[model samples]
Target chain A: MPTGAEWAIIALSLKVAAAAILLTLPLAFALAWLLARKRFAGRMLLDTVVHLPLVLPPVVTGWLLLLFFGQSGAGGRALQALFGTTLMFRWTGAALAAGIMALPLMVRAIRLSLEAIDRRLESAARTLGATAWRAFATITLPLALPGIGAAMVLGFARSLGEFGATITFVSNVPGETRTLPLAIYTALQVPGAEDSVTRLAIASVVLSLAALLVSEWLVRKGGRHVL
Target chain B: MSFDLAIEVPRGDRTVSVTIAPASGITALFGPSGVGKTTVLDVVAGLVRPSSGHVRVAGETLFDAAAGIALPPERRGCGYVFQDGRLFPHMSVQGNLTYGWKLAPPAQRFMTLAEAADFLGITALLDRTPRTLSGGEAQRVAIGRALLSGPRALLMDEPLSSLDENRRDGILQVIERIRDDLALPILYVSHDRAEVDRLAAQVVELA
Candidate 1:
């Protein structure tokens, strides 16, 4: 019995979360591999930086994003000059905020999976005339499929429920940046909006469960075969 | 193919030095455990770098400390069969074998997929995954995978150590057949003297 406005909010939330995952997946995978496999100078530092958002206060993360992507910011100005596109107070900015918030989860899941792989298998592949890149593509990537699926699910869930960063960066404009969580938050501020809140909360739960189930199915289908 | 190698590896408190200059055929690096038998194979296979020495395989110098020449494993053209049978778990038996075959240069593609599968008697298991393979069958597949790379020499590190007695015998016969059929130089590492006596044309005992 959701209204058209509620449906739009839900759809926008899903789109934001999906776009966030799509933007983050490749970068998370590369960073996870670097953190899991290579031993280089500043590796620990890079790992710490990637995980900072998880430990730092969400408000602090949102404030930092604002400084980095706001109109007055250097990166924002450069982006505007280069692409003639602005992210501040836009739906794309909401996705960017959600992606930044969800990056650590995706990277951690992928790193665990990448670490579980037997490095000796890569050496074996090398001896079998495979270059380092080929060995990773043939062995490491396929083995990490389940973890990648898990990462996508985790990121999607995090982004779907994202509130602080999205509200801070994009300011919850209706039909543009007012995602599900924002819609629910706005409902809580109005008189006699308790019923709408209940409905939105149920929608959130249903969407999260569906994402997890779909991810599990995908993982099972694409995962490495074990006897 | 001929293999000549001298490697010095520091293993904690002990520094182990090993040398093998097998002119031809199967050469067994026989020793007790922790005596650097596998380390020597690792050096020739380009998995480990020796502090001071050289490795020459099939008249090509793979590594020379003095000459500052060191080749990576992919370019070395030496196939290594690990003790645990490191078959790609994500791939089927045929896929695993073809992995190396596809990477090998077209000009160096001397061994075909059919030839390797037939030699190892794994033609029937081509569609199966490595996890479903028995230890002996997995080792055979591993060897076939190695052979399909068109290697100049083969290095096996306790390739049958995980099998039962019957499986060991079966693999030993398969290995013996391989020796009789193929002319490639093979460096086989083993702690079991019986295995060495059964297969090796020359035994290099490590102290």
Candidate 2:
């Protein structure tokens, strides 16, 4: 049987992953909409930049996040001075790292959905007295719901399993931010802890599988709506 | 209702200029493909801006290049039906019908939600999403959605052009019923002379 601390780690991991997904969704939608609909200079560059995290090693991404958002970093110092907020070695930093890692996945899913939308539907809405923003809210967004749902599920799953970035940014601190993946890594490192490690590993696998199943269900639902 | 439009658009090497004074009933812009028939409607619908021209629909000046006045599509009050029925895929039949109804001004609103559904015989499909609808059924909903907006004029650009002969005939009947029942003028675009003959009160051929 798993210890209470192990269960707490799993729950905390789920919460952090859910938070990451929730935080990134609106930003993903905005970026995806811009990519799908707009034509401008630096468009290709922006696309490549957004996809950089997906291509880079997770540790490298986490390292970069720490450089930009750590205590000594430019924005980090300013944020600390202004609001006394600190991201380094904190649960919030874990969420930040996870969200950054998950952003590309969310954006890609949403962009595909946004691209699949019929431009004629938007035109039809405009003709029917819907302004551009109104048309987007009432027509474009609803049409793209399936894509958004898929993105959220994928992002959340990715966040839950995020290890390299989370450890690099916030480290593994129990009762604060020692998420499931980190705890699993810690358990494996400790001698004579095979049973605990096995429990945590199984928990991680089950959570990942469940998330994937949910994602599949959402994608199928979305596909039906898109058609 | 009356509409006056004079616009010039470049199509490859040729510049298509249309200057017409439109009166009530279906005015079909009959022409071959790529003759700028769709472009003319685009200008009227505020989808395209003319190099030098003006558009006045039912005494309301929709566009004037001289004065740099151009109304957006939302302000044009022209209900457009495209070649494909652009019903909201996420919305049920009733939700799609009500979308345009909500946009119409209270005084301008002539049809209620139930009335619009009844007009299209889509009362039963009201709760169903557009993906489940057949092509003919989708077109009927599109027509209902457009009608519910209480448009000053209706612009249909080859609305039945994608359907088969049987589907086309079915949609044509619904369209005819709409034309007879509604007082709004319609600018119907098509390349098919038979369809033009079937629905148009006046024909304007574009080259």
Candidate 3:
């Protein structure tokens, strides 16, 4: 039973998480497919770089994102020049940090499913007059749907829980960057705000539980098709 | 020539070299296990790159190493029936059958879905998924799928090896009708002497 203001925080959190998932889904799938199927130079290095956010401190990842995506940074300058937009201290920036944090988990889930595919089916597709892209779209992509679903759910949950990276990169701003975790943190800093903290914590736990249940269902559905 | 292949492919520590020029009809590449019989089919289907040599099927030059011309498997229009019948598990039998049919150009298509289904006796199983099919039924669907693609040449790589003897004879008969009625060039690979003798007009033994 969150108040209207608290509900705004919840809505903002969902928006950020959704945006983060949308931003990372394609890139994560591409990287996952490449890691699972191909043998290329620097593949190991690429894998390590992808997993850096998972192993590195969230603050460090946030620092890296800030360094690259800040207004004065090279990437930030390029983005500004190209898109005439800045992510600095914006909800979009929060999403960017959340996406980077959730990427490794998404990529790992997708890569495992991609690797588990029977590559021979792709070969069979090719011989049946399907182009390389067609084979992947029709055979490999459909077969990996379950994994993709799981990845999205896991990524969404991770994005909702993102605190260190979002706060470090975007800082706390009410109604914009003040998502669930940031709001909870803000409540914690103020005395006599224990009720707000308890409500927010319950909401967070409920959201995470819902995500896990969906992910479990997706895995079960995927298991039936994988064989 | 229906098939004129002289290819050398690397296989682990050793290399496999095969040369066969069959004019037409069923031509079987016979060998024991591990003799790279399937490798030859793979090379013809453009699934494997040959170190040196050329692959000409149905007057079309598919791969010519010296000339630096190698058509990919999709462009080669080779209908390959694998040993295990690699039917897409997620798709229904009808979906699998039409996968290739949908890809082929309208003018190049020689057979319709219904015709192939009728010929292969798989009309009843079209709605079912591949997981529900028996080995022999799956093989029939595989063959029907290949034929409906309207390929210039067919490559059967031990398609009957996975089935029991009773099922094997039934599929063998279906293949015979395809040979006699369709008049399509076929490259069949098998180690079974009796199967080869029954199907192949010419036998090319591989060491």
Q: Which ten residues in a row have the lowest lDDT in candidate 2 chain A?
A: A218-227
Please give, for residues B1-207, the per-residue lDDT of candidate 2 as tens digits.
666888887767888899877777788899999899988888899987788888998889999989899999998989888777878877888888888789889888788888888877889998998889888788888888888888888888898877778888777887787678776788889999999998888888898
Residue pairs of candidate 3 with colliding backbone atoms? none
For model 1 the local lDDT of residue A130 reads 81
**Predicted model 3 interface RMSD:** 0.6
lDDT of 2 by residue, A4-24 (tens): 888888889988998899889
RMSD of each: 2.0, 2.0, 1.5
Selected candidate, larger lDDT, 2 vs 3: 3
lDDT of 1 by residue, A52-113 (tens): 98998877888898898889898799889999988888889999989999999999989988
Clashes of each: 0, 0, 0
2 or 3: which has the higher DockQ?
3
Best by DockQ: 3
Judge candidate 3 at residue B85 and give its lDDT.
93
Query: Residue B44 deviation, candidate 2, in Å?
Result: 1.3
- Which segments of model 3 are wrong by more than 4 Å? A80-84
Output the worst ten-in-a-row residue range by lDDT, candidate 2 chain B: B1-10
Give me the displacement of residue A69 in model 1, in angstroms. Answer: 1.9
Quote the chain B TM-score of every prediction: 0.95, 0.93, 0.98
- Residue-level lDDT tens digits of model 3 in A73-160: 9989999999999898899999999999999999999998898899999999999999999999999999999999999999999999
